[model samples]
Target: MATSNQGYIASELARNDFQNTYDLLVRACASHPERMAFSCGDSHLSFAELARQADALARYLRHGLGLQPGDRLALQLPNSLQYPIATFAALQAGLVLVNTNPQYTAAEARHQFRDSGARAILVLDRLLPLVRAVQADTAIEHILLTSVDDMENPRYDGDEPGTQRFMQALRIGAELPPVEPVAGLERLALLQYTGGTTGVSKGAMLSHYNLLANIIQTLELFGKPGLLEPATDVRIAPLPLYHIMAFATNCLGSVGMGLHTVLIRDGRNLDEIIEAMLRHPFTLLTGINTLFVGLMNHPRFGEVDFSHLKWVTAGGAALNDEVARRWKQLTGAPIREGFGLTETSPVVTTSTSISPHRDGYIGLPLIETELRTVDDDGHDVAPEQPGELWVRGPQVMQGYWQRPEDSAQALTADGWLKTGDIAVLDAEGFVKIVDRKKDMILVSGFNVYPNEIEDTVMCHPGVRECVAIGVPDARKGEAVKLYVSLKDTALDAEALIAHCRQFLTGYKVPSFVEVLDDLPKSSVGKLLRRELRDRARAEVG
Candidate 1:
């Protein structure tokens, strides 16, 4: 694949009829059978083991559970060996895998299960009670349960009518005939649910081609200069595999390159993450801004050896400049910020090792991707002018699952997926996000980007973290409110408000300031401005 001068992906990698997830897994096994494919703690699996277990599970899904092609199966496990095993198994069975967040409550799980029409769920045993509560409300008929220690030691304590042990299913399936690979690219492989901060969560339909295109595009960009040296590159896979960024990068990209990925179940646990880092000389690291900040702040982070670290990619949220700078200073590797949504196989633009990255700019669009900024009227915006970013690429999703109206609203008639993010395109084609359009504070018709306020406030030496949201006001129509968690408890709101005055206009300056312990964030560590907005509404009322 070759990139054009304008940053559009003009071509793609040549594949010898490798079309779907099943095909990719098959190729990985055949290419590097002895290579370590996935590892979590002491439990690990090679490419051959991954394929064998996946094929066994695939047979069980097809024959034992009587699940046919196109059936939905919810996967609610954390970042473990089972994640990739079940993922490949479900895809090979020709089943659409619904990647479920392990942190979801019963109601959220029910909504996803019901919406996706998932007939079965392969979940961790600890979360079985939550699934059992919602099982009657959804179409789910079978519950395949596995424990955290199942990978090391397979065990089944009980046998329920609809619920079975995950390891038992694999064992039973292994006794059956080997499953055959079905070739097709258009078929749906995953129904990855978008983080529903605005409204109810909707599943983004990702086809085999969509996922493959993204993996190849990312590899073409980051896989160069020893990014994916087989058996040599060890990736720190801390992000949940359920998310597209981790799934596509680790499950697909790393595995396809025949690399080893050490899966960390809980990345927020600083001690555990530090221990993982000390265990392996990881070549690559993938995570969000919050993870980076947490790692850099951890006292033991500097103690760990980072000699083997090569590339670090940050996504899922905006990377704080301070965090990126500190990371580079500590590790000597610049934090490459990428931009994408769940709809675009979760990767649209990123900084490569070969390219340079500006402070707040998301680097060039991936190969075969076309990104443009449009005004409210849908007309193209000029360079360096903030507008809604729209993207057209093979990696774009098919649409929202069973939500044609929502999909129609998000996608343009000409095939561009409206990213809903306000970004400015530089002369060099780098994109800098202003903020979410809905989160833009309108104070007396003046646009006040929360990102600007938050960034400024976060720059305060006393402030540990901060979030900005617009509140209803009778006089100004709306007013900016800053919520901050202080690094020093002695710092007061008046002092922080004065700090904001230095960098913001009168309208953009926060009218109200509140110091809290911490701000709300999504599972993936993205700041939740909507939660702050709701809190502001209630406080005002």
Candidate 2:
């Protein structure tokens, strides 16, 4: 799997000692048995204790739930201690883990469960209503629900009985029947879903080899002198686990290197997150640009300690110049912006601790990653010219799960993954994302597909045609703006907006809705999204 493009070789990354991500966990248990691996508020779990819990949960899934290898298990827990425990347990039991957002509506839940062919779900109790509504129609059979306090300290007596029941299941310790071992390197480890801009969200099939190679590559990238020592490194895990970037950089990356992780249960609770940071001085912190801005703007941010912080890496969205500068000025630490997608094991290029931090650039690709700027015809473009970024390496995902058409469109005939993002590559091999090819709106690091919103809006009888576009916002990276042509003369913007609330998420609902006599369209009747985007810019100005 070697390709020579741009004088760089793209080959399958050399495999590491760990068979799979779970194997890394097992090794961590052996090496740092007594060391604390994770902390969520007052509750802490050592590496050995974590491994034992995972084994118990794996046994429950196998003997009690009757789950088999390759079965999909949907997880909708927040960033609590239970998340990583359930995730590793599912992987250890040879089940494909499907990460789900806890805030999803019933419709969204149904779509994902059906699309992933998930047989069982381990969700928080608050989200049970959404699951119960869609459970009958989907393939989900087993339901294991937990409360918010399930993994929290027992002293906080909120829901003790429910937590006790859940713990009892894990402590039952049934003797699991022996089954044939599946090679961890070749097995599908996780099915991470990305919101498809043109169609339904498809699961990105990431194999164990892909994930393990990425962890090794990332470790090598950050292997600077005296910066990150595994025994002393402490990281903040505030980013959502459903996001591939957080899952890789914060969870697996820390565990692989025997680093301590401080889990933030709610990212929105800036006061609590800052308090935790002050209490436990972390060496490395990973989050999106918006999170950095939020922390800097918080009233109590100045009271927190930033002495132990060595690096702050930003991903999921582009870091704005003002936000980066403000963070550096406040904390005296530069915010390193990086580029990645769910397809590239969530990290393609990242700024290292050794590099002088800048605002816009996403730094250079990893040691074995090959990045090229290709034109529409699949021919390579010169450096400095903005074109679609094509990547080929061990970090790239195998393909979209059960989506041959999408997989074909995403990957080239020569095996290059055609990232729909427009970027320019410098002579030094640094890449900067200019624009997105798909009409996907990045609202606070979450992908809000225009098609999903348009479909929901079109359900209204008054709306004939609609186009959703992303408009720049001061706080959020982008806000959704919609232009619509009406079928009925009596329909007003307020009525249509009210109609949209019935089916769309709050973020997906158009912040600015305008009714038009006709929408701009090409001669062939295709909606001209570029024209609408230009109109949005003019309106914003």
What are the models' TM-scores? 0.81, 0.93
What TM-score does structure 2 among the candidates reach? 0.93
**lDDT per residue as tens, model 1, 1-541:** 1136333222443434565667777778777899888889789899999999999999999999999889999999988899999988988888999998787666668889999999999999888888988989999988899988898888856566668998889889999877776568889999998643343668999998888888777767766674557768888888888878888887888776778999998766778888999988888888877677678778998788888787788776666677777888998887888988889997899986557677779888887788888899999898999999999888999999998988998888888998888999987788898867666665543446677677778888999888888887754557889898888899998898888776554666898998889889999998787888888989889
Stretches of model 2 off by over 4 angstroms after superposition:
1-16, 153-165, 174-181, 356-359
Report the number of the highest-TM-score candidate.
2
Q: Which pairs of residues have clashing backbones in candidate 2?
A: none
Give me the candidate number with maximum lDDT.
1
Each model's Cα RMSD: 10.3, 3.3
What is the per-residue lDDT of model 2 for residues 1-541, given as tens digits with 9 covering 90 to 100? 1222322211323233555668778778778888888888788888888887788888888877888989999989888777778877877889999999887777788889999999988888777778878988899988776766776632223242323234555766435543323556778999998988774788999988788878877776687677788787788878888788888877788787788999898877888789888888788888877788888888889898888788799888778988878887888777788888898888888876687444478988876788999888878888889999989877789899999988998987777898889999887787889999888999878889999989988888888999999999877789889899988979888887888787766767788888889999999999998999987889789
Candidate 1 wrong stretches, greater than 4 Å: 1-14, 157-161, 195-198, 440-541
Clashing pairs in 1: 9-368
